[model samples]
Target: MSNVSYYTAEGLKKLRDELSQLKDVERPKASQAIADARDKGDLSENAEYDAAKEAQGLLEMRIAKLEETLAGARLIDESQLDTSKVLVHSTVKIKNQVNGMEMTYKLVAQSEADLKTGKISVDSPIGKGLLGKSVGDVAEIQVPNGIMKFDVLEISRD
Candidate 1:
């Protein structure tokens, strides 16, 4: 059974575009490289040919993995998302209990997580600890440094 990956509409579209590019552009380029290398010299001891073949293999493997991920992906409807508790796509405001510093983050899919933009992956340690938590709830998350506590102040969909 394939585990379904929840993605936003934009994320799914991005995946599709990437797959198309890989199949149309990269795949053909790899094949052409192999063909050119093979034409250059003898097959038995041609390092260039071997390297081209290896690169093609790696490219095909990447294409296959992307296809598999797309097969199990499902687009999440933003309008249907619940805002009462922390969940994927929810922008949550939290306060560090130890330092009283407040920060906001949007829990998103792994593909869309960008820390510089305050988007965090749902599978991340802090995100996992915040999932399903409500306002006034304190979430304890184990990090590389040590355990940290966060107080959930608000949950909103943006």
Candidate 2:
């Protein structure tokens, strides 16, 4: 099965930049480390050589994984997103039913989720609960503690 992922333009660029940095910069550094270690002494007794080889293997694995992610990534057009309801890339303003606290969040792809920036993954508990909900609808999200209700005050693009 193919694992497809969606990303915003900035998120996609960040991924591509990371892949390029790993392949172009880190790959050669790993190769050089291996070569340096190999030149030090006999292969059987060289701990540096073993360590270098292991590091190279890890780097290669990371590169391969990023390549796969990039292959399956699709860019999302924010302009085409529906603002009438909560969906991926929707900037939603919600009010806590119990505390009366209001907060805003932008639902994004899992890889791009950053709470510090008010971006939450669509796969998250709150995001999943809020999906398909329109303004004035209440979302009951089940957390480890209990169910928390959030009233959808507004939904917009951007």
Worst 10 residues of 2 by lDDT: 1-10
Pairs with backbone N, CA or C atoms under 3 Å apart (clashes), candidate 2: none
lDDT for each residue of candidate 1 in 39-60, tens digit (9 for 90 to 100): 9989999998999999999999
Each prediction's whole-model lDDT (CA): 0.91, 0.92
| Per-residue lDDT of candidate 2, residues 66-139 (tens digit) | 88888888998889887799988899999999999999999987878999999999999999999999999999
Give all TM-scores, in the order shown.
Answer: 0.93, 0.93
Off by over 4 Å in 1: none
Q: After superposition, how far is residue 47 of candidate 1 from its true place, in Å?
A: 2.0
What C-alpha lDDT, on a 0 to 100 scale, does residue 98 get in candidate 1? 99
